[model samples]
Target: MKNKTVAFIMAGRRQRRRRWILVTSFLALLACALCCAMLLLGSTIYPIQDVVRALSGENIKGVSFALNTIRLPRMLAGLFAGFAFGLAGNTFQTMLRNPLANPNVIGITSGSSAAAVFCIIILHTSNAVVSIASVVAGLATVTIIYLLSRAKPFSVGRLILIGIGMQAMLNAVISYLLLVGAEQDIPTAFRWLSGSLNGSQMHELPALVISVLIGTPIIVMLGKHLSVLELGEQSAASLGVNTDLTRMVLILSSVCMIAIATATTGPIAFVAFLSGPIAKRLVGVGFSNAIPAGLVGVNLVMAADLVGQFAFEVRFPVGIITGILGAPYLIFLLIRMNRKGNL
Candidate 1:
């Protein structure tokens, strides 16, 4: 009986692993398709051959200029930034074991936005300065929220509450900056604040790309520890996990990726908030959802961008479309959580 039970358990495990692999693979392929759509389905639709030729450095008149100059950067911006937000968002949700603990709800994005706005309006700094300031400010905001949440015995609920408070405060500051900003700067600041992918140049991509590349491996390498951490701090420690070290590393890596993505594209709405749960639901349970989450983020941003570009009478920002999608889900999640007494 014991042997039979062991065999059954092993078979179940194998089944789950297979399912995870298949689902994750599907998500990856979907993301790739969305990326292709982003590149191919703009105002003047370019054929696949033209896109391929243009990508290969062939100067095919209008095709080359349009693809190389405009669409490629936009696609890349959505791909990398979406991946960053998704990965970081999943890390936070998994580590904190709360759906509400994402960077979006926790003021991390708000912190970066406030800093970027200040740079744009008051300081009138360059994009580089704004990016740097936003990163520093994001890191600082997380640190502050973490410190404040560490009162006596730590509480996830307390941390979330504090984060929400911080978000409110930061938003007020952003409004004040807008009010005092020069008329010319207001449009620029508003555009950035709206979390747009417009005018995304290739030059502005390296920092975000590098951050995602570096941060992703670290997060995935620590995936097992992250899963263990989700079992509560004391339980994780008892299982020989260094909860503090793991938590800190995860937070830092996540914050860095998210901050850089925010700097690159202005905190594309709720990609961080919505990616993890969606990935978790799609990929199911037996493995880490990080990769799938990132892929889902990529698909969401790219698909949303495509919709914004062509779905309406006028082009809308990617963020606006995502917000429209995410807000209703947020409301539903809150109601469900409240009903379950988890809120």
Candidate 2:
């Protein structure tokens, strides 16, 4: 009884620490800093007061135009899309029980990208149509992947392996489309593929914002069930978790947000892949890391964009930098998983 009391007190202290909340707050603050930097430190520096004034509908000559039109939209795009990528990516990683089981690895982004590329190169469709097609394609791809992975008793490893194969095939399709695309259309396709924020406008921001806002809450509310699901089907069901309903809701919500984000920012490389692990590592276990993961996603996309803009002689897309950061990690993860006989 004394030992039990001591352990209980220690556990209470750890819970009171509430380190997850503090970490989440820090990430939010950092994301805000990056957003402010993106706004103020563009071609010309604007004072904080002027930025505030411009944001509040005051029409300063040059500062207002730049802030309200260009910088604001770009910053918003990165912010919303990053959150979506992070939330969706972590959802997949947690559900599938594998870090490599993200949208990027599982061909969800490729499905959206492929559909968008086809619209740009072949159909010559409007951006709205492209966005619609991308969303539809993403949903279809996941459905197909899920069905294929459901053969017999269900295997997470089989699902991931199948996703990797699908990703490879989709990548090949993207390369072929790029090759056969018209010369003049090639640049547009390439830019979209590279996941750039150049010329981001207010019109493109709504879909991403709305989807993320709606989906994030649903995921957070279902987070408890989601954590249960991570314990596997038998255990989760034994705990009275509605495995199918919870999974369907989580998958649909995550895929919708991810598709909209991919449409907006061109997948942004591994923002989804890296955010969850980093969040899990920081926040430790026995706590929901969804919000922290999303915040980490925001920081990565914003910071990577800034680095791509100023860290080198030539401007690179945000995806390129993230890809550089994620590839090494992917290799390390693969080796580690193989050694553990998980691959």
Best TM-score among the predictions, by candidate number: 1
TM-score of every candidate: 0.97, 0.96
| Top lDDT model | 1
Q: Which stretches of candidate 1 lie over 4 Å from their true place?
A: none
Lowest lDDT sum, 10 consecutive residues, model 2, at: 12-21
For model 2, what is the C-alpha lDDT against the true structure?
0.91
Candidate 2 structure, TM-score to reference: 0.96
Query: How many steric overlaps are in each model, in order?
Result: 0, 0
Off by over 4 Å in 2: 6-13
Error of 1 at 207 (Å): 0.9
Question: Tens-digit lDDT track for model 2 on 1-343?
Answer: 9999999988876884588888999999999999999998876989999999999999999998898788999999999999999999999999877888899998999999999999999999998898899999999999989889977556888888888888899999999999999999999998988897877889988989999999999999999998998988889889999887888899999999999888887878889999999999988887889999999999999999999988999989999999999999999999999999987
